[model samples]
Target: MTKIADLRSQTVDQLSDELLKLKKEQFNLRFQAATGQMEKTHRVSEVRKDIARISTLLREKRAAS
Candidate 1:
């Protein structure tokens, strides 16, 4: 799992890309859960948090820029 502080150290575009990837992963996780094939249920929450973290970092970077 990526931390907010770590994400804060990254560039805006990098953060955006990471956020998109995380959202995709989250979608996959949900799909897996729906099919009763999720091996890690906690991952759903983790991915959600990562998405929030990336968004926060992106917002901060934008504000700073």
Candidate 2:
């Protein structure tokens, strides 16, 4: 899990890249859950929250500019 403070220090481009990666992982987790192959079910929510955190930070950065 990524801390909000750590995310806040990253550049927008870096945050975007991290968001994309998290989204991809989210997709895979959903697929695995559907197929009954998911091991760490809690990870789904963790990734989702991380994506939200990054998005919120990005918006804050844009608004501050």
Candidate 3:
């Protein structure tokens, strides 16, 4: 797994793609949980944190411009 700093180093486009992917994964996790098929359910929280981290970095990067 990539570190938050490493993720921050990426370009906006890359970060956007990753953010989208994370959201999709989060959706799937919710579905799995609802169906009682989720393994490692704690992962959902981690994904949320990652999304927030990425978004915060993105905002910082933009504001620095």
Candidate 4:
């Protein structure tokens, strides 16, 4: 999970990269769940929240500029 402060310190490009990675992780988690091979089920929610946070931050940055 990423801290908001840490994310806030990063540039937009960096945040975009992080968001992409998290999205990929979320996809893998979903796949794992579907296959009944998921161990840490809580990670799905964490990754989702992280994605939301990054998206919100990105929107705020764009709107501010």
Candidate 5:
């Protein structure tokens, strides 16, 4: 899990990369849940929150530019 402060220190490109990675993980988590193979269910929510955080930060950067 990534902290907002840690995310804030990253560049836009890095954030985008992280977002993409999280999205991929999110997709996998969904698949696992559907198959009843998910071990840590909390990961789904954590990934969702991280995705939101990264997107929010990206938007803030865009708006500030």
Candidate 6:
């Protein structure tokens, strides 16, 4: 999980890259859940919230600029 302060310190490009990685992770988690091979079901929600947090931060940055 990424902290908001850590995210706030990143440049837009860095945040974008992190967002893409998180999205890929989310997809893999969903796939794992579908295959019944997932052990950490809680990670799904954590990834989701992280995605939202990054997205929100991105929006704020854009708006501020």
Task: Provide C-alpha RMSD values for all models, in order.
Answer: 1.0, 0.6, 1.2, 0.5, 0.6, 0.5
Using lDDT as the measure, the top candidate is 5
- Best of the two (2, 4) by lDDT: 4
Q: For each of the candidates, give the backbone clash count.
A: 0, 0, 0, 0, 0, 0
TM-score of each: 0.91, 0.96, 0.90, 0.97, 0.96, 0.97
**For residues 1-65, what per-residue lDDT tens digits would candidate 4 score against the true structure?**
88999999998999999999999999999999999999999999999999999999999998998
How much is the lDDT of residue 16 in candidate 3?
87
Residue-by-residue lDDT tens digits, candidate 6, 1-65: 88999999999999999999999999999999999999999999999999999999999999999
Which stretches of candidate 6 lie above 4 Å from their native place?
none
What ranges in model 2 sit over 4 Å off? none
**lDDT of each residue in 1-65, candidate 2, tens digit only:** 99888998899999999999999999999999999999999999999889989999999988998
lDDT, candidates in the order shown: 0.85, 0.93, 0.89, 0.95, 0.97, 0.95
The list of candidate 5 runs beyond 4 A from truth reads none
lDDT for each residue of candidate 1 in 8-64, tens digit (9 for 90 to 100) = 678888888888898899899989999999999999998988888888778877898
Worst 10 residues of 3 by lDDT: 1-10
Score candidate 6 by TM-score against the native: 0.97
Between candidates 1 and 6, the lDDT winner:
6
Task: Please give, for residues 1-65, the per-residue lDDT of candidate 3 as tens digits.
Answer: 44987996799889989999999999999999999999998899999999999888889888898
